[model samples]
Target: AQEVHCLAHGLAHCAMFCAISGNAPEHPVISTKSGHLFEQSVVEKYIESTGKCPVTGEPLEAADLLPVKVASTVKPRPLAATSIPGMLSLFQTEWDALMLETHSLKQQLETVRQELGHALYNHDAACRVIARLIKERDDARQALAEAQPSAAVAAAAVAAASAPPTSKGGEPAAKRAKAAAPAVESSAGELTPEIIASFEATSKTLSKGRKKRQPPADQTSAEALAAFGEVASEAVLPAGPVCVDVHASEPLAAAGGADGSVILFDCAKGAVGAKLAGHSKRVNAVRLHPSKPLALTCSQDKSARIWNTDGTQLHVLSHSGDVTGVTLHATGDYCVTSCSDKSWSLFDIDRGSCVLRVPDGSGGYTCAGFHPDGLILGTGVDSVVRIWDVKSQQNVASFEGHTGTVTCLAFSENGYYLATGSADTTVKMWDLRKLKNFHTIEPGAAVGGLAFDNSGLFLAVGSADTSVYDTKTWGTIKSFASGAAVSGVGFGRSAATLAATSADGILKLYGSSS
Candidate 1:
């Protein structure tokens, strides 16, 4: 059933109110030209009272009323204000709320923007701080790098200036002072601080000779030539002794006579141990084994004789031509001999056989030396020192700085450096690590023999005036006038006894007369 409401009138037809209540068929209706419905009794009452229709106010009688016709069979439920007008009012209220929320969100967004800007500012400041710190660190490092060298140089200069005028026993006081002078112009200014330090350290250390071996207590003088004793050669060597060696480990010493004789001497007592006679010609070179009781001698007789320390002959090595020089390997298992035939031969001692023979194609080989390791050989030719790798049978390195025939070659104990002496009166120090000559010294005479001490600290070069130099600085540590041209120079195993063989037949011994 449809709910009826009185909109304009209190009592109306049976039909639903057209304005207030929607049209429904289940409601009884009474309508006329006004298109409204009312109850039949209400119309009759209205006609009896006012004699007109309620809506239209037209004159109407009860008998003239007609019922409105509807097609729907069931009555519709009553509805509240759910129409377009009501929806429009609700939409207006929702639109106002949405506007308020948008305004609040805009305010929050602005606040977030301000906070983000502050955070960005802080990040930028932190970045700047980090950049500044990095720059400062780099600057400090650069400053330190620049200051260390200057400080080191200044300290070195001060120390040198404060040093005493007299040297302990090496270079002359004036020469040392001149060499150590910081302002003495040279190539040092072109080198780095580290390189300069290296050069300076070498100079300082070399200027001070071995302080380890104190002179004998009985000795009172630092004389240059205090001959301990002399060993006389047999039969009066006509051409003088050509080569000499001293066994520092023992009190034994040997000298090769010009008449192809080797004279052994007991250095401590200054007595003759034995006299070896084998070759028919002059002995050119002789070397005693470092630890063994064996000695090797090469002669112009085209033979090299290996002798026991007791002067007994062990083996004989025959060469194709006059043997000029011979040196044994540190191990005593091998030896190298240089001959006038422009060839150098490597011999196995125990096997008594030649292992390899390398010919100097350009010039006659004058001297041969074996490295400490016995893996390489050095041969001196005209103006060049050729280094051969024994295993590969190939020349590994060649040094050429000498203007005359290369006469002598000596390897340092470490086997990393080589000292080559030439007849041009120059000795060049070659560093094998770089395969180049590092330094050169003029000995003022034809270099006959070169020897590096067992410790590799001192290098003795035999010339007109025998000169001993510190290996590191290549500085002349001491100079001894041999009275005659020095033919050979060597230090004993202990490096305390220095022997120099000159044209004079007498074997000169230099040491403290303990």
Candidate 2:
């Protein structure tokens, strides 16, 4: 009975444990033998009181409480191993996200670096440009500073050199001497002052004795000559021919005869030496070469003839229209002629051909001449004088001042001055160096001819009134009325005799001490 009770108690306790743990009956709890006996005895006592089974509600019995042996089978939960993989996948995803962010940051950093590099390059270039500019500015400043003193010193030196020397009294010596000189001559001559005074009272009568008288109307040449009282014999003669050692010295006297012949007189001999007679019409102009034996004569027949001193015709230049004037080169190798056709042509003696033709597009040409250097040629067309370069064959300058036709021109020996005579009764002196007009001498009548002395100290101008001018001050030294309206004037080679031609077919000569 105790064994039955003990079995019942063990069965009850096992059933209770299994029920609390929710274990299967086949997986029941096992204990030691002593503990099982204690449990069985407890269970038997309880069962007798209740008379019921604790499990299954069958009946209280020791046989029914027998221990059943079951196999130990326990399966793991589904997908238990997959938890670790899922966790690993989550970690891998997080790592990928972090890597992506890092890459994006790196890309941004690279972009920023590239931008910075570009900006740095631009800044460097700007800095270099600025540096170059600064350096250039500094160099310019240094050059200016270095040049300032030299410029100032040079200017000051020029001023000093140009300043006139001062005297102790602050007056020029020349001025003082001029003021002290006597205005009247001393009475020391053999002719007493009283005699001189008496002579001066009849001076008008004496002057009238030399006056030209008009010939009887319709008088013949013989009658006129007889009445004129040997006027040709009374004419003054130059000392002799002054042969200048210089080559091609220009003739002092160039005259055109009524017979259409051109004659060049030796300025020193006062004698006719050469006659040029190539023109079929009246010769209007004649000029000797500045430094050669060649002569150029323009005629009303619309042509100019180049001739040798021996009267040999070298060339007969025909123009499209009437030739008015002709001038020879200093070397006598070239010549220029102005025509009423409003054109001028340059002739080369060596080539025997017209090298250039210039049209006076504005007006008709009246006169022309070569400059002293022979490189510049000047042409007077109406009231304007045009200068041209022969080598370049170009017009260089034009001078406009004359109111009427410019008829005559003379260049100074030094090549620094030029003189022109116009039909406006004015003579102008031009400074070639300065390219400016220097002086104007109004002779009160149409100026027909002009000539400068070899020394360039005096100028002879022929008009209705023949006059001599002091070149230094442009002052008229003397003026003598010609018997007839003068057509030409020239200085003799000695610079002492002045010869003039008039419309009356008379050639008059005047002597001067100064």
Candidate 3:
């Protein structure tokens, strides 16, 4: 055969190198079927001869001869590096680099997935917040609608009561009672615009009148205080007296006892006027009707009784638990009672129906009272005092400082301050306008009762010993020794006599001798 040498002095085709095995230099192109590469001219000539592959001896055609692309640049390699071990080492290095790149791509994909999940969680939270806000708005609107009618009727009654005597002297008692039962659904006790205006007007007028008619100095002087002594004692009951209230215009007093008996007394004669009994447990509080001849009493029997002084029971306000406190409105037709069941109820006395039931957020209420104008309510729970707008049934103000249970609460006569005594042996005076505690005094013992005289100038605290403080100076003006814990204290209708009932079943009377 003629000496036809391989092109470029090559001994054999170098698929991965520049004319040398294991010498990868540039632009590598792999075969699609055999996973190998060859020089373009070498493959073409091999296919033309015998029409078969040199290595596999397979039938090959010219079209099967593909080009193996490479870069123009090349590097020389050592002849010893053409061994199979060196080639294997080079392949392993390339495989490692490819695996590292794939791992980096996988990490990036996982991070993207985590970011997407966090975005979805935030979106869900925002949606829930929006839904909650919308629900609250709807509930407030419904409450306002339910409260308007009753507020209107209550406003009219207050206006009539506070206005100067008209030709008719105001709405008839029957007509006022009828208005108390609103035609709307029973979800009452909301403050409407009309009611707010009416209450404000009445308060302004009352304030001016009070300023002009301040009580005389000699009314509660120490010289007058010395005249107080033990008066006639009523028949001893099965249990000690717990609460007492005097008729605002009569010489009569009503006392509720632990025996659940509401006893009436004639202050002038020092004798029992009537004994009204109905409750099956201890009586906690009693209040004389402002304008009517009725007496309201709350008891541990889980009910409040409204009775005439003549021993005639009028209405029994039943409750789910022990009634702890009761207060009648200035109109004498509406009453409010607080219970140990975590609720307080507003009632229509003449209609004998419940107008509203309000639940306290902190367990049960210990005591409750109405503002002199009847527009606001004060309640004692735990160690704090909460003031509510009566019409709206919303807590508008809260006063805190007591370290123990707020056992007793009494609003000042002028409606400017509230006196609350706690079991911590401290009494605090709260200014309604400022919504802050104006003064705090520590008595020698735990306070059992609190009372403000009709002048709003004197505050009495019943503790180990009953002591009176002048509101202007906030000083102890006088002290009385009852020898026992005084549980109830109050002034007569005319503010002429001070009376206190001791836990030993004795009622002591104090007055200035003429």
Candidate 4:
């Protein structure tokens, strides 16, 4: 039987080789004309250029090549190295080659380290840029959201202003629109075009009416204001009453205590009337509705609630943080709340839902109030008092002279002057029309609250003691040493009654029967 062979790199296994390349062909082809075997691709290229086979110089083309299949199954033996000197020489050559290869690998490793350092530096730079871009994107989105109301508000305001001078039911178009249009239903205080439109309409009506508004006839006279003195003192709360408000319609006053209880003291009888309890933490502020039998109170429990005279909770409005302050709208159907979350919210009192929320961006609010006409809102953000137009949600103006946190503020009934009290022991009066601070009073103690009489003739200052100032002369009409911090102050409708609430849970009344 004839034996066939295999292809290997050693000469010991060299049996067949390509005639053209002098190497074993993985796929060999034989030339039919010359009978010479060659690698198919190499010889194919040669034929294309020369048109002849290499070994025999026979005329051949690609079509003349025939594939030859080897049938060898025998394994080739390795070349045997027998001499010791020959083996030593081979080992020495291999070691030298390995050393050269190791040096090459070490150089490649150093190059890789340098490349890695550059890659890390670039990656860090990219991260920083990405972070900055993300912050900018967030800021842009907020600005866009805040700016969305401008165009709509302007259009709505114009439409309202252009309405008929006459009334639909003996009332202005703006007031009618305010009654007809419903508040936007929202749990978050995001401004929408519809909300802006509604707000502007109300602003138009209120702003118009407020321009020519006059003091009511039954206000306290300047003579009666000067004859004020301490008339009564009573402990109306278990803990310090942090705030107080007199009921505009009844002979009662509500004091919110640090123990989360509201004391309903009958100012007429100089005695306790009722105790209302609901809040789980210290009450921050409280107010009785201007004309209704409802009491509104906000607490550190992060909520504000409305209650009827019988102590039934009417509505509970929740907030994102401890509600810092709450103010009733002129209509008594709505309320505004300031929060420690750096946001303030508007709520529909009857619906118990958040109508709008506005983020302050700089600092959390410490207090809140509304203009007497209800066209705008004033809130204390840190040491500054920012006035916002409710219609456009635009920051219309800011009072920025306070050196400490603005603790409380009140708008005069005539609506021209705004008095803000601060923790810096000073009270500043801002003339809204002039947009300037017209007066400043240093109370020698932290000013916690301020109130103006219905006629705007007297200013009630609540601090370490209670002081009454004549608005015209800016002179102290009367002063009472509370012996404790006065957290709140108020005047009766006719200025016949002056009340101050102390941190010691005492309600001090000062007035003259004559």
Candidate 5:
């Protein structure tokens, strides 16, 4: 069989090399081989001149014997002399279309990415809202569960009362009275069988000895006339309605005295009840006891005094320095006083002794108050409120948020909430159950004192700017121009009255529709 001859050039050389090397011939490998062969020849020539190969010992004159000739010049390919403007124009249009497609694809990709980001953000927000809703639902369920039993009992009582009355009511009442009569007689004194028998025998003998006597006609007539008179008087008499004369009186603005004196007013009648004048110096704070008519007053005289509404002194507490604030415990058994000497002390009014002292290590205590339970005391100083357990005399918590000194502290009636008024012109509500602040209300004024009403519906904030806040929503409920800085505010026993003591020695009262 004769083998066909194949020309050795570009394609033929590639096929021959592939068959010989058992691998496809690559352009990069062929170029690299050519460069290596040229470098080797140059290296061999240099080694021959130096009498030794630079890389290896070999004769160099054998490399010069190879024929070296000037290579013929390759002719350039001739350009096709044909005009095809339409084909070029078609290619340019295709390229432009391709570029537009690519740009549109990129924009779509960017749009998709933006939508994905927004979707992710919305998903996160939805998850947060769901979590909050779940928490609220759980809280409501718990409250409902706690109130269920009371609701059922009330329902049962209502149902029983609404039922029709029995017809033999008189007979039943007589029977019940007959059954209770012996029990009452036995309960009055121990009744022995012998004593009972002796009493029965004596009664029988007395009955036999005594003769029944009939009342005279004049006596019967007199008794009948008296009965008629009593019935007539009752018929003409108007039923006395229960009158709760709430003397809600505005405090008198009399001539101001040099010494601090706070006046107590009858909130229902709008009359000045008494003028409190125990403090020898400027009174900085005044608070009313929860149940007692006693008022606690702290003064620059370095003392706090307990005064009755009748202007009589009940007790006097001496501080190391001028007292700045005083608060009575909700139980009215104790009071807490803060002093400019950087110390605070808890006094037991019943025992007439200081039960606990918060040392002046952390600076002067500007304000102090007892928690609702009377088991905890809070002192304000240096822009922080430190809470201490009265029983343990241990500092339990410290609140840090105010930029200025804390001037006042108050606890809600439920004992689950605390409010602090600061010189920073803000009031912060602290949740005792969570041990964290819930919210802050800025009345745009220097908060001098804070108080929560008995119902926990309103907060009386005494400020130089004079603003009050609704406790439930923390909204500004009312405003009044207090002529001077309000040192303290208190709610009376009834939620209808509010009292504010100012630096101008005037105690103002405000009436609430609630």
Candidate 6:
């Protein structure tokens, strides 16, 4: 049985190949620890990087490799050349390939070094800025302490004086709420009552402000949006972007390329502002923080990264499989990412910790986003839209109607509606207030991305084409299918700008150029 008729001669052969490359080693070497043979260069690189034996994973070094004195050396004839000229031609071709590979490695090394240099420079700049901000914060804190008695006494009077809202970013109820919340940093990642209360407070504040918010004065008319077209010739993505997001308040957009890069471009200026290079595979989705100069992106690399306008890496959250979607919490303090690993996680921005990681037992999530109220999260799994209570990490509701896999999702700014796009070539609108799928539309293509502009004027869906529809009437404002199949779509404040990234590497900004 040990020497079966079919393989008896090969099993007992004296010839050995490198454990790493499975090729006859020119100068064979054996690990003293693991007793495994290897091609010297290949194993040495592994040992150098990980400091462990290739097979045994024990401590290893180049010096541990002992050169073998084989009875005979034989070069592999994988090409099976039958004549001298054929062998010579194979050798010549191999030599050329080796030379080219060496040149390519050198180029990659140079590029890595350049990237390292830029990273160090950016780090230094960030450190300086952080130091300045810290000093200013300390000074301000001291001044606040000194003025506390008078300010406390005159608080009601000052409130009557029509001073600008003291809250920063909704104008710092978050800071105040954090102070008041009992389990502000609950180590167990529980949604405590105090935390829920804070969420309610922020949600109420934002919802109230949203009610009075108006479209920017420069917002384009619906007619202009119906005639949407490329306003600039500039795009920064090195290739076709797989996903994109337009800044709600700034003339900026972020696009994720198939090459695993995120380019932050200024739509107003028609130039690239920053390059976010960390993902090792294609980026699947990207989202910009509502008002902060921050970005969130998920990728096939099984990680979601948060970055700032300065190209500084804020956080990197890892997952078990390709991360399909990422979304920011309404308050900008948390981000949620869904992955193909049959799970999704909520990460706290300031603490850099996963508050909760929920198992998606039904199936891996295809897309995800937060409710405008910040108290709820919606995720796509199979054809169902599962809504979770942010504080409790419990599935509170599900919208089920689509016959195909859900592909993308967006929450309306009004806090009452949720839009789920599916591979069934349809987008469904669910009323969160009623917990029901109220409407659905077939866009005639698989929906890839979805967005609702700030003013609740339109919904942009990306598929074979990108279409903008009036939110109230569900009527198409425009449908753009010109350049290439649309991959992602976004809307600037009040639909002042419509940004669409296509499969042909064009990031088109459509709106009144005024």
Give Cα distance to truth, residue 343, candidate 2, Å: 2.0
**What is the clash count for each candidate, in the order shown?**
6, 6, 3, 2, 11, 4
Off by over 4 Å in 6: 1-188, 192-194, 212-216, 233-235, 238-241
- Model 4 lDDT per residue over 170-210, tens place: 75322011111112223355656765565556545655564
Q: Please, what are the lDDT tens digits per residue for candidate 3 over residues 161-272?
A: 4556435565443201121111122343543476456656665566446545757654565445545665555544544646777776677777777777778878888777
Which is the winner by lDDT between candidate 3 and candidate 5?
3
Estimated TM-score per prediction? 0.55, 0.49, 0.60, 0.61, 0.49, 0.61
What are the Cα lDDT values of the candidates? 0.67, 0.59, 0.71, 0.77, 0.56, 0.76
Expressed as tens digits, the lDDT of each residue in 356-415 for candidate 5 is: 665645577887877654555677877877666444344555567788888778887545
Clashing pairs in 2: 6-40, 9-40, 240-268, 240-269, 248-291, 248-292
Q: Tell me the deviation in Å of residue 125 in model 4.
A: 85
Write out the backbone clash pairs for model 4.
189-356, 189-357
lDDT of 1: 0.67
How many clashes show up in model 5? 11
Indicate whether candidate 2 or candidate 3 has the larger lDDT.
Answer: 3
Deviating ranges (above 4 Å) for candidate 1: 1-236
Prediction 1 TM-score vs. true: 0.55
Instruction: Give the top-scoring candidate (lDDT).
Output: 4
Query: Order the candidates by lDDT, highest first — what do you get?
Result: 4, 6, 3, 1, 2, 5
Better of 1 and 4 by lDDT: 4
Off by over 4 Å in 5: 1-258, 512-514
lDDT of 6 by residue, 201-257 (tens): 887687667655777786666777887676765555656646899988888899998
Q: Clash number for model 6?
A: 4
